[model samples]
Target: MNYWLVKSEPFKYSWDDFVNQGVGTWDGVRNYQARNNLTAMKLDDLVLFYHSNEGMEVVGIAKVVKEAYPDPTIEDPRWVVVDLTAVEKLPKAVTLKSIKSDERLQDVSLIRQSRLSVQQLKKEEFDVIISKAYEN
Candidate 1:
């Protein structure tokens, strides 16, 4: 299964909102690269829920409930979205600062492309972050 990271500001759409909704179509992605990432998603893929901007941390995990589909919110055929359901929140959030400092996470797309809202994650990178989040 492919791993991914999707970012949202807490005020715009927080992890709690996602949990409350049960499942949601991840939308509003305007950038071409981010849209391409969404198109790459597949059913049952795992996603990391990140609170960008204000929070700057990876807060929860989610699963792709549906594959890429035309984003219903717009008429643009170039845009698409994927359905995702909240799996669980991390015991401890892995902060951006911490990720930037970690040798294992140095090559993560999150640091290499700081402004990317949706991006791919290597399994090792994903595993390392999961390990860090579970660290006591």
Candidate 2:
């Protein structure tokens, strides 16, 4: 399955919020690239839940429960959303600073396109990050 990293400001939608919601639609993406990433997601795909502004770390994992559909929260019909259910919390958070400093992740899209809210992650990169989270 494809892997991805999706960012949300902890203040707005914390990891706790997602966990408590049980399952929720990941929407409100206005950027073309980020919206496209949501559209491309398939059921059961794994996603890294990253807290963008505050923690700047990947705090949990989630699985796509439903495929993309038109976002209900969007005024524009072009945008889409995906349903994701919390899978598990990371044993330890993987911070952005540590990821950027790691040689193995230098070429990751996250580092290259830091401003992108939703971005694809290579399988190897996904595995590495999850492993590192446990190691930490």
Candidate 3:
């Protein structure tokens, strides 16, 4: 399965909001590259939920429950969204500071393209972040 990172400002959509909703649709992507990443997602693909702006950390894991479909929140046909369900909250948040400081994640898309809200992650990078979250 593909690994991905998706970001949202906690004030706009927090992990608690996601879990409370039970199922969430990933939408509002207007950027070409981020839109492509959304389309690339497949059912059951794992995703890291990052709190951008306020927290700047990976807070939870989610899984794609449905493939890409036209976004319901907008009238624009060019945009699409995927249904995701919260899998689990991380034992601890994996902060941007930690990720940037780690040599293993230096080449990750997250670091290289900080402005991209949705980005692909290599399997190793995904594992490393998970490890970091669980680290004491």
Each candidate: what lDDT? 0.94, 0.92, 0.95
lDDT of 1 by residue, 1-136 (tens): 9999999999989999999999988999999999999999989999999999988999999999999999999999999999999999999999999999999888888999989999899999999999999888
The lDDT, on a scale of 0 to 1, for candidate 3 is 0.95
Counting clashing residue pairs in each candidate, in order, gives: 0, 0, 0
Better of 1 and 2 by lDDT: 1
lDDT of 1 at 115: 95
The stretch of ten residues in a row with the least summed lDDT in candidate 2 is: 127-136
TM-score of each: 0.98, 0.97, 0.98
- Please give the RMSD of candidate 2 to the true structure: 0.9
lDDT of 2 by residue, 47-92 (tens): 9999998989999999999999999985788999999999999999
Query: What is the descending lDDT order?
Result: 3, 1, 2
